[model samples]
Target: MGKLIENKWFLLLIIALTWGSSFILIKKSLLVFTPYEIGAIRVGVSGLLMAYIGIPALRKMSKKVLFWVILAGFFGNFFPMFLFPLAQTQVSSSLAGILDSLVPVFVLTFGFLFFGIRSRWIQFIGAIIGFIGAGSLMYFSEANREESQLFYAFLVVLATACYAVNALIIKEKLQDIPSLQLSSAVFSVWMVPSFIILVLSGFFQNFEASTPTYEALGYLGILTIMGTAVAMILYYKLIQNTSPVFASTVTYLLPLVAVIWGLLDGERFTIWYMVGGILILIGIYLIGKNKKPKLLS
Candidate 1:
């Protein structure tokens, strides 16, 4: 247990398993639930679960910090939660996961644009390259031949941009807070609203009427537990123990799991996907390799 706790590789594996599997879980949940319902349930259940265990950490946070937490919640957690499922309705989970791997690239791009942070030239070039790769993946895919479906794939890209913004906010504005505290507080602030949305969506009625709903809900439970709550805890620990770049390498592994799961689920795959995904991953690597600027004051 002690070695597992301290080993960076072990921590990385855990994150990859928890977060990487989340895309397919979203796919499974969407079998019965609407994107809005899935998003609300995710945030609501994870928020409650974290709050139950994270009370001590939450108490230590200042009220003044709640604003940033809420911002992160809405952008980083809430919006992406909704967007991924929505995108998956039209896009493959494999593609969604591949697009999600663009978060670090967007992080670099947004950081330099809005935060007045300086970045190396390679990072800028990488962002452009990453965009191109994403475009190719969306536009050229036989799996998403419909022009409208391709447009929906862009929604996943936009979600990554939101994730980038949230990452910057957390680093610059909420540096003093612990990871668990930040996650718990963000979820706590958003929890009630999300739950209210879920309830208003008439989820319970559908849930009772369908056996598949039970199986879908079971997948969602794992998604909430392993993907959101527990993964946040592990991610925070990784950040503490390693450089940000090292911790972010989980991005590289995520699509592999998503792609493998997609294949097993009988989703189509082609050499074109491999080409575009490689380019995006390369761009992400370059972005991470660039020296990071100081967190915003």
Candidate 2:
């Protein structure tokens, strides 16, 4: 069991499962809270929880390391935390999951462009295919006819870009830090800011005592503890143990889990959406093929 826990593949699977289900939690939480409230509470709560480990780690960081940590936290956690919930306001959870697969392609693109990393032609081709699929996904989306929904879908893509930047920062700059310490410290940076947002969003003033409110809060708790906090620890560990592109491959499994949850929730699932998702997955496969193989051990 302990050995399995340490295995990168196992950690990948666990993070996929946890994060995939997060969409539904967000959807459910949205039943009672605004996107701002959900995002603020999720980040603020997760940050507080992480502070237990992070405060100690904070004491040990030099200024340079702290800057990278805070940057990673912003791109990786803070913005995406809000963007996703906002996107899901108009987009389906499954579609949000599908769009997230763009992370690896963007990772490759940004890595090659800014980080002095070299890439093969095949990877470039994969990036093109991935963008085509993403464009098709958005174009064919039921939401495309509506300007607001289309804008929201783009937000999800933008969030994926943020995630890509975060991954590169972790791989290039913060690789030497312990994964848990790094994750805790990153999340800790947003703790106070998130709480400030929560308060400013009128979360306290609009408080209600109702069954739905309690249920939404419960979902938020799970989303924070499992989806944000625990999954982040494992995700950082995976990134530290493997390449960022490889770690982002968890998105391949993430959509499947999210689609299942969406279906169970009775959300619409169209054939075109599936076609778009398949294209994205194929693009990811080609991208993965371009990677020099890593031993699964």
Candidate 3:
């Protein structure tokens, strides 16, 4: 209905600003904390919050749904959460951002591969081109940087693949689960094993809890609750009413929002970003849609 579309767009606007600011917040947080610690705080807080909010619905999901939810938490959040920081330690944020743009492609491919769904070629190509435009922003002159860059790129791409995999799994296997409950359940399930390992490995003591660390934890909380949790609902609702092509437009905006936050954080800004963003936007604009085929082939 008109009400849902208007509501979803308004919610997405909040997601944009909040998720965009998360980049700057994460960058600032990384200054003092380890990546694992950040991931822990991020998912842990959001999971706890959502579990509280969606307690009844979460309790209602079948055990099979819980299994898929746990899988999503691990692949989508746990694995990627660790990979991103480890990879970023060696790779530039620009490179990581570009590589991470593979989310939609992976989502579509996984949907087709395991779920047996076919996507419209134009939408697929447009998403890929948008990724290329995002990727080009990361390219810079460096001697023989190709090998190392490619490795880090794979890690980033893998993270996005995890995301896409979760998307499909949720759509196929866990569609009966409520969005808010699913988001919280996934995070909470992942947080359990993560926290246990940190404690057993003695990484828990290393958490210094400095001012920036606390601030970063706060940002991660925001990222988990708003960006991951709330945005999950918004995106799910968007998919219900809008075509996948239009829904995927969120990908085009995410990186642009990241770039915008980078500028706001006083990072170097150049005309190339404008060009890349324009290309991505154009690609998204060209790929408008009114119908969504079943993700199952």
Best by TM-score: 2
- Winning model by lDDT: 2
Query: Clashes in model 3: which pairs?
Result: 116-297, 117-297
Per-residue lDDT, model 2, residue 153, is: 88
lDDT of 1 by residue, 1-297 (tens): 978977999998888888889999999999889999989988898889777645666566677677777887788778888888988888888888888888778777777778767788887888888888888898787536854467689888998888778777776677777677778877877889999989899887656756897899899999988888788767766655664455667788888999988999998888778988998988887787666566545
Which has the better lDDT: candidate 1, or candidate 2? 2
For each candidate, C-alpha RMSD in Å?
A: 2.4, 3.0, 3.9
Against the hidden reference, what TM-scores do the models get? 0.91, 0.96, 0.78
Off by over 4 Å in 2: 292-297
lDDT of 3 by residue, 71-152 (tens): 8667765777777765655554544554455566666656667877766777677667766665664453111165556455
Across residues 204-283, which tens digit of lDDT does each residue of candidate 2 receive? Answer: 99999999999999999999999998998889989988889999999899999999999999988988778888888888
How do the candidates rank by TM-score, highest first? 2, 1, 3
| Full-model lDDT for every candidate | 0.81, 0.89, 0.61
- The 10 consecutive residues of candidate 1 with the worst lDDT sum are 237-246
Lowest lDDT sum, 10 consecutive residues, model 2, at 288-297
Q: What's the C-alpha lDDT at position 117 in model 1?
A: 72
